[model samples]
Target: MIDVKIFQTPSGEYTGFQMSGHAGYAEYGQDIVCAAVSALVINAINSIDQYTEDAFENSVDPDSGSVFFQITDRPVSTSSQLLLKSLVLGLNGIQDEYGKKHIKIRLEKQEG
Candidate 1:
């Protein structure tokens, strides 16, 4: 299972999430799993724009297996919060056939 956390910062909001619980064959080719996970994350972030006007700037740390999403020069609103929740939950559904699972999301808002 993956654990996700979202937190707020002075600059912007961020989502910190991680995945675990893959053993044996599922653990053999982690690179592929990472790639798939990254893709799913990117897609979910992109989907947020459809629900809100805020544009998202994202970075994936392959080394730490963490993904960060920030709003670039946009006003944050209640809609943005809702969108964020939806985005994370959507990505959590992505799974691998090797018993590797992706789940959990943490979101934080940054104080201006």
Candidate 2:
């Protein structure tokens, strides 16, 4: 299963996210669940990089099916938060469709 954790403050602001593991819904190249998750994650990272002034740290490992992204800049920008929220929405939609057996979404509370 694909495990996605969204880090947020008690006030419901996004801080970071970590995604790991493969859905194994199908063969490597044919797993739609993995593809959807990857697309949302990569897009969010790229959007934050290109459109927002927010600084962040990220690591990606395709071989191990892991991706981690966190805002390094204090007080995440509105644009960055919006992009991350969009990502969460997309991920939730995928989870809703594929079920927890294939994808899992977890919200982790953080001290802001």
Candidate 3:
């Protein structure tokens, strides 16, 4: 399963997200679930890089099926947040279609 962890600040700010694990629903390149999730996440990251000045820290390990990301210091730009929201929307759609067995979405709140 693709474990996606969404972060939120105590003040209600969108802190960023982390995605790890593989759906294993199909073969490597032939996995629709993996493809859909990858597209949504990569597009959002690219959009943030293109449309905003806010910097984020991220890492991707294809071998381990891990992608981790979080804000550096500054608040995330509105465009980035919007794109992230859109990513969530796409993820939700996938979860709805394929069920949670393949894609797991988690929300984690920060204390401070």
Q: On TM-score, who's better, 2 or 3?
A: 2
lDDT tens digits by residue: candidate 3, 22-112: 8888999999999999998888888877887888899999887798877665566677778778887898899999989999997899754
Cα RMSD (Å) between model 3 and the true structure?
Answer: 1.4
The TM-scores of all predictions, comma-separated, are 0.45, 0.97, 0.91
lDDT (C-alpha) at residue 65 in model 3: 79
Better of 1 and 2 by TM-score: 2
Cα lDDT listed for each candidate: 0.53, 0.93, 0.84
Question: Which tens-of-lDDT digit does each residue in 1-112 have in candidate 1?
Answer: 4555555555654333334332222464555544555566566566666766766576666555656566664456667656655555555454324343344344546454
* Candidate 2 residue runs with Cα over 4 Å from true position: none
Provide C-alpha RMSD values for all models, in order.
6.1, 0.7, 1.4
State the lDDT of candidate 2 residue by residue for 1-112, as single tens digits: 9998999989899988998999999999999889889999999999999999998899999998999999988688999989998999999999889899999999999988
